[model samples]
Target chain A: MNELHIPTMAQMAAEGKAPEILFWVGCAGSFDERAQKITRSICKILQHVGLSYAVLGTEESCTGDPAKRAGNEFLFQMQALTNIEVLNAYAVKKIVTGCPHCFNTLKNEYPQLGGNYEVIHHTELIQQLIDEGKLKTEDNESFKGKRITYHDACYLGRGNNVYEAPRNALQVLDAELVEMKRCRSNGLCCGAGGAQMFKEAEPGKKEINIERIEDAIEAKAQIVASACPFCMTMLRDGVKIKEKEQEIQVLDIAEITARANGL
Target chain B: MIAQLVFLIILAAAVFLFSKNTGKIRRNILLGKDADRSDQPALRWKTMAKVALGQSKMGKRPVAAIMHLFIYVGFVIINIEVLEITIDGLFGSHRVFSRPLGSLYGLLIGGFEILALLVLVSCVVFLSRRNLLKLKRFQGPEMKEWPRSDANYILFIEILLMTAFLTMNAADYKLQALHFGHYIKAGSFPVSALIAPLLPSNASSLVMIERGCWWFHIIGILAFLNYLPYSKHFHILLAFPNTYYSKLSPKGQFSNMASVTNEVKAMVDPSFVPAATEPGRFGAKDATDLTWKNLMDAYTCTECGRCTSVCPANNTGKLLSPRKIMMDTRDRITEIGNNLDKQGKDFQDNKTLLDDYISREELWACTTCNACTEACPVNIDPLNIITEMRRFIVMEESQAPPSLNNMFSNVENNGAPWKYSNADRMNWAESD
Candidate 1:
């Protein structure tokens, strides 16, 4: 296993087109079409508001979290070093990844491999873009009377503390935002963390996602919004399994942002 | 003056009983040998500072950590009160303040008694949290053979202590009424004021009650001191240092493997034959397999069940209870020590007890997720023992779960746990 050594946000921001931000479409976001579409929509909004940005598709890599949690520390280190080297080569900085796992690993775990970077999750960047008047919600009235709920992804909310950005982004659209009983630091794990997303849980009493989606239903939310691509996928799956897909919608925070933008 | 002599006698008796019981506990409960000279002192002192003073292990949860800090400080402060009580019992006069800065001393003593009460109440809350409220992670793992005696002993000791405390105050209050003809100035403890109304109006009755309660209190202390080594209260003394001396390594860091190359090299040489001596065991197979510090963790378990409650493996209906792992190790150590202490060289006959103490199935069920290690307020590293057991099984017996063996072989052969070809590994990198 080779190391993934990537550049920091400060370094990347200094080089290339010196784009206002580098949107890092992680492995999950690249593979998942819905997430890809939402990211594209967010990018379209960023471009529309004249915010200079470069999408660093090549700078992306598995955050090596799955490997580390699996006790393959050497593999994770190799992946981290390799990612660092690629990012360094591209002179990429000010990273914005849609995946909380990638964002958390790049910001928190990479320092152990000697890669320090100012990595922001996509919601923070999108909300920042909106706050700066670079993105707008033209159809804010669409969610005027509709009640929505925000599901705090463990990695994004508790693992890193990106709670405010996603909620703020949704609230900016004037939607009725309700919080599930367990939100923020005490937010329940979506059972998708620690690369449990890739592996099947060994026949537990309940699927972790069902527990979380049930909480959303308890909140009486018409839609359950999440920031991480994995959370979106799990919640969507939970909605299907619980036979509530017709009554409830699972959406990525970016999709909500896109809808608000009338894109 | 007679009372002063009695107090001195009680103090001496307490010291004797406490020292005796603690010695027994060190020998039996933890099988704690006088630490080896090779033991790290600098590490121990550093650990004491961080764990005893800093509450480092309790840092995972703030409420629990802060509560522990109060208890620790309260324990230290109340020691002065214990000495004061001993002196008062020996002296004709209850002159704990009969020294320099006596008023200030009394105030400090009073403050600490109140704090001690608070700490005691909080401990009760913590206990309730484990047994009743069912805080998600505080319930200890269910043991196949929990020392049923230990639970009974713990309940008995706590009740005895609380009773002794209340009785001691009652004695003091009655004696004060007898001497002063009304009420003695209630010391710093506000609860002691309750003694004023409860005192018998008849002087002789009050005196008899005081004498009886005084003796009962002293005897309770002695019995508790003697019982310390045999019961779970052993942690009451050991928790401070054990929590501090915890492993500095990350939760994932296992006991380092023995230098394998040296042995393998000699084994491969045509003229060489390996010695029949035990192969360098990577993990613990029995009590002797544990390091002294690992043994220390056994003595330090309060049996509060905090580790078992939070364990993902246990909650998922697995056999791996982190609490029981420590208890099993502790019990096995005690059993081995008791055997060795009584039978000396003939202790090898008792090896059968080891197999029954911990099952290989329970040992293998741990996911090493660190939730147990994380939730332990005392910072007992239960995962280390699990990993150690795994290491021994894999290295010594060449035994492993079938899938794990396949995974290990795949990694050695293909540089990945999966059997996928290297071409697939490069696909993620090569793809646009």
Candidate 2:
């Protein structure tokens, strides 16, 4: 077993040391059993690349994405202001988020609340790591020739114009990358946006996640690659509901890159 | 002299009525909440050019774009002849520019004839799309009897207008060749020349067909101008202004609630006191609660259903049709505007854009995926209005779905949407 160290921002601050990047392990990444794997994968990649990064740990809170999207602006600003105070106290300058929701909120919505930071989605960081040539899975053939289709997370894709980074991260692997019928700017939501993750879809014939997963099935993708935590949850449930659990697998980009690189 | 006087009265009445209706539309649109879309003039201009004038977004569907261009370009260019027609009508003259421009007049009329033919063919194709073939985008819950008939009615009017223009030119061409009185050879007729052989050879009969079509064509144009305020075809004019004022931010970034921010600041900081502002409505319940841009978006909707067709919720049998949202908004405002006209400006109607027209179920069905916004060729944003209504539901009415209420409470209490304690946030790191 490999031993690894994860530092909290408080620990770094107490040690009078500053990490280069703050890894925003969003609420789903922290609590969801499946998303925890993605959180670890991102940490492993940061460690392997010898980049200095720290987590906010207990001091961190939800970025108020679900609250905001659910139209509880009061609750949203409350959570946002709390998180901003924490981030500003640490004088955090840069961040990489494991989820698109956190990435979008920290990057776009935070500035108006005075929580300005250079934020990137984990897939974007992975793309950059690949470009810098510090991260490699050149010899890893686990995903070679597998029909891997990438799901564009709404927050990462049309929301922030990040259609390329996730695909580019997948490109470094030796896999057959296919596209669902709706991809990029035309990508379908996984029924989790606007706080739908916590609610039953309003009287619809079929769930949105089921509809999105069918697109993956139609594309003949064995492994559906995703970048956002909420997307991963919805897609995993979708595959389970379709009884395609045996035939199809849902994995986040970080998990894929981490596994392929033996991290 | 009597004919000219009648024409002058008809033109004045059409212009006056059109202005009055459009002025009411402007007032209704202005009744919406203010929004700041005027900061970036250059960017807005470029967007208007690309989305409206250039029709860049329409390029997604090549067949529709090409056909639409025929009508759009032909309509703009052929209207040059409307000016000539007006001058001729007022002065009681035939081919008013013929003697002054000479050969240029012939070239212009030839081009107008060619354009009129294309517009005719295009309207036929557009009509077929609605009635014959029945493209799925054109049919939906919002597309009721009137809207369906209204679409065909516009196309039929266009066809009739083009037919009159060409047939009138055809009869005039025959009279010119026969050297009839005041029908001197002037402009060329490339398309109408072909129809000339089909006309009756009798000079008096030719004069009647020519004169009748002349009156019909001009009157039809005027009627169509007045109809612009009532029909979805008003997009031809509103699309320009709508695109210019569209939300330019990234689709994911919803506008932060400045009002909420002030209240939150007062709560967080003991020293800070919020300004004594009028208690802002949480979100939009009525059309007037929405921003002017959102109201204009309602008017600018072409009823194309591109947004609804691409909507994931709509695609999967959900009640959330973004096109319906826009239409309902337009209908609501128009209803309010009418009531205001009848019962004074302060009259309050119990109806609202939210539940009265758009249901709560339809509102919740939206994932805020922005598929509708992306799909709109004219840059209409159905999502902004969706979020605004959602804000009204959650913040003002406290009527978010039970599931969302639980999530909100969890977020408020535990610092996350789920019921996990903040103390355990770093548990994932314990694996190694």
- Best candidate, DockQ: 2
What TM-score, over all chains together, does every model reach? 0.68, 0.98
lDDT of 1 by residue, B1-432 (tens): 676676677778778878875676565634432233235677767777766566666675678777666766766776676666666666654545536555675577467556656666666766665457766553334532345445545554544555456555655655664575434555544555565476666767766665676566556666666777776677777877776577654343333232332344354455755545444454567866766777888888877676776554465565668888888887778777777768894658546323577776666555454556656666788776766665566666666656655655554444344464433432332222
| Model 2 DockQ class | high
TM-score on B-chain, cand. 2: 0.98
Candidate 1's residue-wise lDDT over A171-244, tens digit each? 78677789887676446656665445555565546676777788898998988888877788888888999999
Candidate 2 runs further than 4 Å off: none
Score residue B194 of candidate 1 by CA lDDT: 61
Second chain TM-score, each model: 0.80, 0.98
* Candidate 2 local Cα displacement, residue B16, angstroms: 0.6
Candidate 2 lDDT by residue in tens digits, B1-432:
998999999999999999999998999899898788888999999999988999988887799999999999999999999999999999999989999999999999999999999999999999898888999999998897888888999999999999999999999999999999999999999999998999999999999999999999999999999999998999999999999987888889989988999989989997897877556698999998898889899999889998998898898898989999999999999999999999997888888898899999998888888889888999999998999999999999999999999999999999989999988888898974
Candidate 2 residue-wise lDDT, A114-197, digit = tens = 999999999999999999999889557789899999999998898999999999989988889999999998899998998989
